[model samples]
Target: MWLEVLLASVLGFVIYWFISRDKEETLPLEDGWWGPGVKSTAKEDESIRPFTVETSDEEINDLHQRIDKFRMTPSLEDSRFHYGFNSNYLKKVVSYWRSKFDWRKQVETLNKYPHFKTKIEGLDIHFIHVKPPQPPAGRSPKPLLMVHGWPGSFYEFYKIIPLLTDPKGHGLSDEHVFEVICPSIPGYGFSEASYKKGFNSVAAARIFYKLMLRLGFQKFYIQGGDWGSLICTNMAQLVPSHVKGLHLNMAFNSRNLSFLTPLLGQRFMGFLGYTEKDVELLYPFKEKIFYNIMRESGYMHIQATKPDTVGCALNDSPVGLAAYILEKFSTWTNSEFRNLEDGGLERKFSLDDLLTNIMIYWTTASIVSSQRFYKENFSHGLGTLKHERLKVFVPTGLAAFPCEILHSPEKWVRSKYCKLISYSYMARGGHFAAFEEPTLLAQDIRKFVALAERQ
Candidate 1:
C-alpha cells in the first residue's frame, strides 16, 4: 500500500509539471495591427515599380479586326438555340459593336481611375484606389474597401465610387464622402493567380489585411457581396481590430441541416409569399440560381479538381472564354433575361461596360485562373467546415436587396453575426448590388458607416 501510494503521487506530480509547463499557441496580433508574422515588402515594390498600363497599337488594331470579323459572321444554330439570339436582331447588335463601340475610349475611361499593382503572398495583386476629390475642411475621408466576386471585376464599383466620393455628381449625398479601394483577388484581373494549390479565402483575408495596413489605414470599413462576402467575413475574423466595421449584401452559413432547415424554411417562405412546403421550395429563385450555377459551373468542377488541364483551353480560345463567362452575367444578374440573345444585359448595363469587364478577363488571360479559386475553396470540402456561429463583436451592417437569390432575415444574420448593428431592406437591386444600383448602394453604405463612426 505504501509503494502504490508513492507511485501514484509521483505520477500526479509529473502530469502537473507537464501541464503547467506546456505553452499555449499564441496568435500573432499585438493590439490591432502588430502581428508577430513578418511584414511583406510588396508595397515597396509597388511604390518603386508602379505597373504601367501597356496598350500596343498593334494589339488594339488586332482586337478591332476580330470584332469586325465576328460582326460579319452569321449566327450559328447553337448560338441561336442556346443563347436565344434572334438572327436579324443579333446582326444589328453586332453591327453596333463593330461600328459604334469604342474600345480606346473605354480604355481611357478605365485609366481615369488610379490603378496600382502590388505583390502579396507570392502573387501580384491589382487594385484601384479612388480618393474623394474634396474633403471637408477638417475631416479626413473615411477609408472603404469594396471587394468584387466571381465573373465581376473592380469595374463593378465604378458607378458607386463616384457616388460615394463625389456625391454632388450622383445627387445622393450632400456632405458624406469616402476614399474607396477596390481590389481584384489574386487570381482575377491583372492580379496574378496562385501558382500553388490550397490558396483559399483565409489567405486572401490575411493579404488584404496587409494591404490596408500598407495603405496607412489603421482602421477601415469593408463591404462586399457574393465571394466578396466570404473574403470580408474572413477579414473580420482574422483581423477584427483593423476591420472597424463590416457590411455585406450576402451571408453564408454552414450550420447543421436539422437546425438550419426550419429557420431557413420560415424565412424563405416569407420571401416567396408562401406559407408551408419543403423549405427549399420557398426559395424558388435561390433554387433556380443554384441549379443554373451547378449546370453552368462545369468549368468550376474541372478547375477545382484539375485546374491545369482546362486552364490551357481557356487560355487559348476566346470564343470558349466568352461563352463560359458571359453566361454567368446572363443568369446571375437577371434570370428572366437568360434566353435573350443579348440576355437583356443592356437593360442594366451598356455593351461597352459589359465588354470592359470581359476585356479585363481577356487581357489578363485569367479565366481559368479565376475559376481555380472556386476549386481551392470548395473542392476540398473546406467550405463544409462545421458551423460555429461567428462571434463578431464589431459593429456590422447588412444591405438586403430585393432580387438577391438568398435573402437572410435580420434574425438569421444576427444568429451568426453577433454584433449586427444596422439592417436595411433595399428597395431595389440584385446580387451585384454595387454595380447594378450604385446610388442606392452608396447611400446605404454612407448611412451605415456614419452610424458606425458614431459608435
Candidate 2:
C-alpha cells in the first residue's frame, strides 16, 4: 500500500512539471547579417567608439535653399490641419526655420549627452549613454535602455534623461537612479541604415540586446513608446533572463482582444476587468477607436507598401519632410490639435525642439531608410510574427497616456505581458510621453522600477 501511494504521487508530480515547463517557453534567438553584401569571414569588430553630431555650413546652406525653393500651395480656407499641414502655417514654420531656428545650437544640444557607436550585424549603431551625476552612496545606478520610434530620434529622451539619471537634483527621490542608454534604431538618426531587406523589430531587439551585453550589463531594465515598445517587448521575449523589467508608454497587443473587447460594451467592461477610466478612453468606440485608427493610419499604408516612392520627394525637399513628420507630432500628440490652425504645435512643444527632430532626419538623409522600417515590419502582415503570439513573462509595466493613438486597457496589455506588474492611467500626456511630459514619465518609470525591484 505504501509503494502504490508513493508511485501515484510521483506520477502527478511529473505531469505538473511538464505543464509548468511548457508555460515557460521563450522565443528563439536567431542570427543575421544586415550589411550590404555577403557576410564576411573576418571576425566582427567588438570595439566601442565615441561618436559626435557634426554639421557643416554646406548642409545648413542646402537646407535653407530647399526651404526657399519650396513651392507654396494655398490651403483650403478654414481647413486648418484637416487636409494636412496647413500651408499657411507651413509658411510660418518655414519663416522660423529659415530665420530663427538654429541648427548649430541644436547640434550642441544633441552633443550634451555622451554618444557612442559600435558595429552590430554589419550596421553602425548609434546610442547616447548618460550616467547618474551623483548616485546614492554605496549604490550603483540601475542601467535602463530606452528606444525611440518613427518620426523621432534619440533626441526625444533628452528631457527625461536628467530626471532619471539624477532624480534628487530634479526634486525627486534618489532611491532608483538610472544610467540611461538611448539608441537610434538602425536606419534612423546617426545609425547606419540596413542595406539588406527584412530588418524588423526582432533584428533590432537582438542587436540592442547585444549592445547591452557589450556595455557590460548582464541584466537591465528597458523602456519604450512607439516602435520602441515593440522592440523592447521582443527583447524581453528573446532573452527573458537578461531583461530585469520592461516598461512601455505604448502597448502593442493582440488584435484578438482588440476586436472582442469593444463588442462587449461599457456595461460589461467592469465585469471583464476594465476600469472606469478604460471605458472612458475606449468608449465611443467608433470615433475614438475605429475612425481614429483609420484617420491616423493613412501614413502607415503609404510607408508599408512603397516607402521609397514618397521618400524621394521627402529626401529632396526639406520643407516637405518637415510637414510630413511634424503632422504626426501635432495630431498624434493630441488629435484635437488637428482642429486648430497652427495644429496647436506650440502648446506642449517649442519650435526649436520640433525642428531639431526634423533636422535629425533631414541632416542624416535617413527619411527613406526610416520609412523602409514600416515596410520591413508590416510587409509580412500584423499579428503573424512569432513574438506577437508569445507572452512576455518578465516583469512588465504599461503607462496608458490619455492622448495616445489608441487606449490599450490593462486587460489587453496583460494578455501579452503575462507578468504585468504595473499599469498606470497617466494623468495627462500623449504619444510622445517622454518628450511632452518628461516628469510624468520619469515618475512613472521610478514608480514601476520600485515595484519591479521588490519583485
Candidate 3:
C-alpha cells in the first residue's frame, strides 16, 4: 500500500512539472508571432540632412573627351545580323554617337535639377529633389517620390518636372504644386552598389524607407515603373502607413495567385485586351518575343545565375556594353522596329538623348553592377521568397502603357492593391512612357492627382 502511494506521487509530480514548464515556455513575448519584433525601425524619423555630390568639372570634361574619341572610331562591320542595323547602317550610327552627340549640353541639362548624394547602409545614393516654385497661401506641397528603372536615370522625368511643379507650362493653374523627389536605385547611376551580396529589392525598399524618413516626409506618394515598380510595391508592403499612395506604370503582383486567372482560363491567350483584329496585329510579334527571349535572354539567365562572371566581361568591353544595353531598346519598346537602322531608336528618343543615356552607363562603369541587380533578386527561386501583399489603404493610380512587355489587367492588379482609385489605358506609348511620351504621361499624372484631391 505504501509502495503504490509513492509511485502515484512520483507520476503526479512529473506531470505537474511538464505542465508548469510548458506554460513558462509560451510567454507572451515569445508567443506573439505577428508583432513589433518583426518590423524594421527605419521608418520612424523626421529630418532633412544635407549630403554632398562629389563631381569635378575636370571629370566631366574627361568623360566628354572619351565619348568624343569613341565617336571618332568607325563602327566595326556588324558581324551579327541578329536584330536591327546591318553592318553598314551600324557604322553610320556609331559615327553619329562619336561626332554629332553633345555630352556637355546633356550634362548641363542634368545639372538643372537639384541633385544630392547621401549614405544609406554604407552606400551612397543619388537623388534629385525639386520643390514647386510657388505654393498657395498656406497649403503645404504634396510630396511625391519618383523612382526610375534600368537603362534610365532620373533624367527620365526631366520634361515632366516643370509641368508637375508649375502647371503654368501646361496652361493650368500656377497654384498646382508638388515637391518631387527622384532617386537612383543602388548601382544604377550615381548610387553606389552595395558591397555585400543579397542586396535585393527588399533591401532597396528598406533603404528607401529610411530615405523618406530622413527627408522629413512622414507621408508621401510613390511613382515607379520597371524594377522601380517592384521596389515601390515592396515599400508599400513594408511600411504602408508612411507611403500614402502609389502611382505605377509597371505593376507586378508577386503575391496573389488569382492574377493567373487569364493565363489559366484561356491558356495564356486573350491577354493585353486582344481583340480579333488585335490578334492578327500581335501574333508574329508574340512569336518574336519568344524567339528573342530564347536568343538574348541567355545573358539574363547568366546574370540571374552567375552575375559576377558575366559582369567581369561587361566591365571590360564598351562594344559589348553597347550591344548588351542597346538590344533591349530595340525589342522591348517595339518589336516591329527591331530590324531598322539605329534599331528604330530614333522613333522614341532623339539620337542625342539615346547617346546621353548610354554615356551615363559607360562613364559610371556601372553596366556590370546594374546587371547584378537582376541576379541578386531572381537567381534564387522567386517562388520560395516570402513576398508581402500590400493592403494599401491610401489612394492609388495606374497608367497602363500599350507596348509594355507585361500587361497588368485591372482585375489582376486589384487583387494585390486594395486602394486602386484610378486607372488609365494610355492611347500610345511603349515601356519608357515617361521618357518616350512625357507630355501625355504628365497630363495623366495631373489628371489623377486632381481627381485624388477632390476625394
Candidate 4:
C-alpha cells in the first residue's frame, strides 16, 4: 500500500510540474507620471493634434556655421573606422552636408506622411500614422506600432512603411495590409523629453501602450529593433491580450545561454538548440561575443553613467555629433566596415538619407535627453526590473540578421518569448534592418503576420 501511495505522489508531482511550467506569465501593468512635479488628479488631455516637420533659415544657417567652425583632426595613418569615424571621411561628409545637403527638401519629405502629436502623461508624444491607400475588400488594415531606438528616429521606418502599408503598390501581396504608426520615443526626436526621473523602458512601454489605445487600436502589432525590442517586449508582457503579435530584428535575452558555449564548444552547441548559423555567428566566442561587445559597448558605458558630460559636446557641434552618431551606423551595420576607410556607410545608405536622420537630432536638440534614456533604463542595474524577469506570452517573430552587433539564437529568444512562432535567418543585414534592408524586413514581417493571423 505504501508503494502504491509513493507512485501516486510521484505522478501528481510530475503533472503539477508540467502544468506550472506551461502556465502563462505577465508583467504588471504599472502607471507612471514623467511630467514635471507630482501627478494631478484631473483627467489628462486626450486630443491628437497635427504636427509638421519645419526647417527655418535660422536652423539651417546655424548648422552650417557650426559645420564651418568644426576643427578637423587628422586620423592616424591607415586607421579606418576601427578607431572611430575617420576624420578624412568626415571632412568629405561635412562638405556635402554644408554645401549640398538640403534640409528644406528633407523636411518636405518628412511631412509627406501625416504626422500628429498627443499629450500623454503631461508630455507631447509625436508619431506618424499611415493607412493603406486601398484596403483589401473584406479586411481592415492591421494597426502596427513601430518604435525607434537610440541614434535613430522615426525616419528609419520611411522606406519600410510604404511597403507594409501599400504592399500592392510596392509589387507585393495586399493580403496583409497594415496601418503603420511610427512613434518617436519620448525625449528622442520631436517627442517631449521626460522632465521627471525614472522614465525607463517600462514607463515608455506603458506610454506607447496608452498611445495605441488612444489611437483606437484595442488589438495591434508591435515591432522594434534596439530599445524598441525591449519596449515592445515589455508591452507584450504588460498587456499580452492587447498585443496581437510582437516582431523583432534584435532581441535582448536576460536568460542568455552564451556561457555554456565555451564549455560545450562549437560542435556541441546543438545540445543548447543553437542552429549551425547561430554557431557560426556566435562561435570563436572570444572575438565575436566578448571582444566585439567590449569594443562596441564603450559608448554604452558612458551613456549609461555620464551621458550629460559627453552629450554637451555632441549637442553643441554638428560635426562632433555626426562622428559620434555615424560611427555606430558604420560598425553596427557590419563590423567589417570598421576596416574600410569610409566605414562603408554610404554603401547601404545614402548621404542624404543619413544626413536627414542626423538633422532630426540636430534640429531638435534632443541628444542629451535621448542619452538620458540609457541612464534611466540602466540606472537601477540589469535583470532587476520587473519586466525583465517575466517571460513575454505573445506570439513573437524574430529576424536574426547576420551582421547585428550580437546574434541571439532562437533557443535563447524562445526562453524569454514563450510564444515564439516564427524564427527566420535573414539573408543579409545588420542592426538597422528597416533602413538598410526594407524589402527583406517587409517580406519577413508579411510572413510573420500571416502566421500570427492564422493563430
Candidate 4 lDDT for residue 120: 92
Candidate 2 global TM-score: 0.94
Kindly indicate the candidate among 3 and 4 with the higher TM-score: 4
Query: In candidate 1, what are the lDDT values of residues 1-455, reduced to their tens digit?
Result: 56544554564455345334423221233222122245554443534135545666786666666655553235665453254334444555456655786767888888888888776555677888989887756878888899999889988998888888887666665566789999888888887777776667767777788788878898999999988988888788767778889999887654412223332334434432333332442255445446645545665677678876777766664444554566566556665566666666667877788777877887788887788888878875742532223445568899977666555666556645767888888887777788788878888888888888888
Model 4: how far residue 30 lies from native, Å: 2.2
lDDT of 2 by residue, 18-62 (tens): 334435567899898998899899999989999989999999999
Give the Cα-based TM-score of candidate 4 against the true structure.
Answer: 0.94
Model 4 per-residue lDDT at 417: 83
lDDT for model 4, please: 0.89
For 351-441, candidate 3 gives per-residue lDDT tens digits of 7776677777877888778888888888666655554333444567888876776556665576566668888888877778788887777
Question: How many clashes does the backbone of model 2 have?
Answer: 0
RMSD of 4: 5.6
Per-model CA lDDT versus the true structure: 0.69, 0.91, 0.67, 0.89
How close is every model to the real structure, measured as TM-score? 0.79, 0.94, 0.78, 0.94
What's the CA error at residue 167 for candidate 4, in Å?
A: 0.6
Candidate with the larger lDDT of 1 and 4: 4
Which residues of candidate 4, in runs, are more than 4 Å off? Answer: 1-23
Off by over 4 Å in 1: 1-49, 64-99, 256-299, 339-341, 382-389
